[model samples]
Target: MTTIERELHIEASPEIVYEVLTSPEHLVKWWPDEAKVSLAPGEPGTIAFLPDYPSVPLTVDEAIPVSRFAFTWAEDLQVTFTLTPSGTGTLVRFVESGHADAAGHAENVRGWDHFLPRLVEYVPTTVAA
Candidate 1:
């Protein structure tokens, strides 16, 4: 299995960051054009229109508070988010494994690199509200 990982330093606590990461409202602002997600623990969320590509049916594999989240796209592709604490901020990392080929891996990594940072941008604003 090939693994591509990205790390982000966000100016927010893990708890606050986790909420933004898991909540649909926050995700829509950064990720999908629109999001349908449930806030209750263990519920599922979707980040629609996963940019620069055709539509694919993706399923949420897991949503754990302040730690990890995962989903699977077509062809057994999986994307996982792992968050860790770094001093006063959170260290967010994304790992896209289970991709069948190099093209799939590059596309996902690029898409995530584009969208995930936007999520970090919203963290401060969401937490303050």
Candidate 2:
């Protein structure tokens, strides 16, 4: 299992969804670590999850506003998040890929299950404009 992808629809605008994904403040919530990570591409960041989850040192690889974000994950994996406008809501696509071994892939699959719903829950319901 070299690649895993999941999609989520949240009741927020793309910009709002994008902000939650990139902001260090919000990332700290669902990401399960306390690290001084920046939201800019090429920046280096570290995520130290609970000991059971281990820590991942990463570099911001792609940071396009209100659309896409990608970062290096641990040693041989890259994680990417893509956002798109979906009607009055936003669509979030999360992808993980690299030369990860089976264990890495399975752990990440479980990790996403743990975190992304937190992301969906973090977003507020859309207000009529």
Candidate 3:
């Protein structure tokens, strides 16, 4: 059971960050061109970069507004996102479990490093207004 964790700080409130992270419409703004996530929490979501990786369909397991969201792509691969309010900003914590091997972990880490920066850019400046 390998695990990878990452943290990102955005200049937006937790509520706004959570919405951008969980909603498909907003996800498209930050997610890579190769990535596509359909649906949102409490419904269904899928993470994939077709032709390069397997399409891992998922169902949202739990969601608590601006606090936490968890989903299972497979019985073993579970992903969770946690948002914490931090001094006028939001702390985003991402955890992924059950990478079968080093390659899988590396791929995921690289993918996030590529997209997470975009998320920071997408954080609405109007949040404080």
Candidate 4:
């Protein structure tokens, strides 16, 4: 299976970064257009891009406060976000696995390339307010 990995440094604490990554309200600001998901592990949910793409089903696989958040989506794909404290900020490691083909992997890579930057730009200003 193909996997996508990315690393980003955000000028915020792990707590803030984790909240943005996991919270449905914060999610809509960056990635999905809408998110209906419980934070509890094994809980089911859906994230929609809207007007273009259909909603994708997902399940929370893990949620460790301020450190790790992971979910399984689209039947077989799993995405994990790992957070670590850095100098006055947080280092985020993102991994998405279980891609069946290079085309799918490349498509998601582009998606993340667009969205992750929004996360970095949105966090410090919005969350700190």
User: Whole-model Cα lDDT per candidate?
Assistant: 0.75, 0.80, 0.75, 0.92
CA lDDT of 56 in candidate 3?
Answer: 55
Cα RMSDs of all predictions? 2.9, 2.7, 3.2, 0.9
For residues 1-129, could you state the per-residue lDDT of candidate 3 as single tens digits? 588888988988888988886676676677733334443555655665545645656777777889997877744678888999998798889898889989878887887788788888887643543
Clashes per prediction? 0, 0, 0, 0
lDDT of 3: 0.75
By TM-score, the best candidate is 4
- C-alpha TM-score for every candidate: 0.79, 0.87, 0.79, 0.96
Compute the lDDT for candidate 4: 0.92
- Candidate 1 on 32-126: residue-level lDDT in tens? 77666554434444445746433545567777888987777554777787889999899988787887778867887788889888988889897
| Residue 100 in model 4: lDDT | 96
Please provide, for model 2 over 21-101, each residue's C-alpha lDDT reduced to its tens digit, 9 standing for 90 to 100: 777777777775766567777788777787764667778888899999888867668888899999988899999899548
Off by over 4 Å in 4: none
Model 2's lDDT to the true fold?
A: 0.80
